[model samples]
Target: MKTLYDVQQLLKKFGIYVYVGKRIWDIEVMALELDHLYKAKIISNKEFVSAKLVLTHEHKIEELKIKKLNNGGGL
Candidate 1:
């Protein structure tokens, strides 16, 4: 998918909804779910790779924001 929202929408189409009270946790859960779907052949390799990349990128961005905030940079 092009963005995290797009990946979430794709998961929604499969009746998957995940939340763990934290954004990073939620993204991790989504990644796990995507892996399962890929293994089960429910999604194509291209779709899985695309979604994974989006998730990873978003996760990194979130982490960087947290780091910046922790470093007293007001994000």
Candidate 2:
């Protein structure tokens, strides 16, 4: 859960594949799936927290990139 790829692999283990054609959208969907898994007690607290940290970090990075692109700096 150190990277987005790790988070994706975790989700994939449960047959959850998310690709909404946009990085932000995909991360959002993955968050939802993670929430569901956590609620179902399918994942441990440590795994949930680690995955969330990864997702949140990645989401922020994507948001920053979008902001930069809109501001004319671009990625």
Candidate 3:
């Protein structure tokens, strides 16, 4: 997860392919483009909402569960 390639591969496994730029600054531009497309009705509201929920809830829950497991030390 240290590199963009790692993130791309992880996302691809979930059927998402993000065209990330070489530099970190490009992520904002890409996000803006995505917002514009959604605003123009190119992307559905369902897709946007689902993506937001997955990024927020799914990832956080998984990370927290893992942390709890590790801290419990095989409990």
Candidate 4:
């Protein structure tokens, strides 16, 4: 289990990252990160593609945000 601090430390490495949380506990933080990236226009379609691939390979959960992208939209 990643403590909030651990997650924060990982996020600090880059302005953005693919967040993998065990549950909804980190949704707000992840949303804020994505929000910052979106506001800065740093999230490109290609980055989304890459992030999705990484998330799928690294995570096994179905409730996270990345899984939401598999619902037919081409993120």
Give the number of the best model, judged by TM-score: 2
Candidate 4 least-lDDT 10 residues: 51-60
Q: Report the Cα lDDT for candidate 2.
A: 0.95
Per-residue C-alpha lDDT of model 4 across residues 1-75, encoded as one tens digit per residue: 134444444456675454555444354545457456656776665554444343443344535455677775575
Total clashing residue pairs per candidate? 0, 0, 0, 0
lDDT comparing candidate 3 with the true structure: 0.50
- Please give the lDDT score for candidate 4: 0.51
TM-score of each: 0.91, 0.94, 0.37, 0.33
* Stronger candidate by TM-score (1 vs 2): 2
Q: Write the per-residue lDDT of candidate 1 for residues 23-48, one digit (tens) a residue.
A: 98899999999999999999999999
Cα lDDT tens digits for candidate 2, 1-75: 699999999999999999999999999999999999999999999999999999999999999999898898933
What does the lDDT come to for candidate 1? 0.94
Per-candidate RMSD, Å: 1.5, 1.7, 9.1, 10.5
Which regions of candidate 2 fall more than 4 Å away from where they truly are?
A: none
Stretches of candidate 4 exceeding 4 Å from the true structure: 1-22, 46-75
lDDT of 3 by residue, 1-75 (tens): 343344345445546555554333334433454465568876677654544444444445656776787897586
Model 1 per-residue lDDT at 35: 96
- Against the true structure, candidate 1 reaches a TM-score of 0.91
User: RMSD in Å for candidate 3, one decimal?
Assistant: 9.1
* Angstrom error at residue 3, model 4: 19
- Model 3 residue 37 distance off true place after TM-score fit, in angstroms: 6.7
Among residues 3 or more apart in sequence or in different chains, the pairs in candidate 2 whose N, CA or C atoms overlap within 3 Å are: none
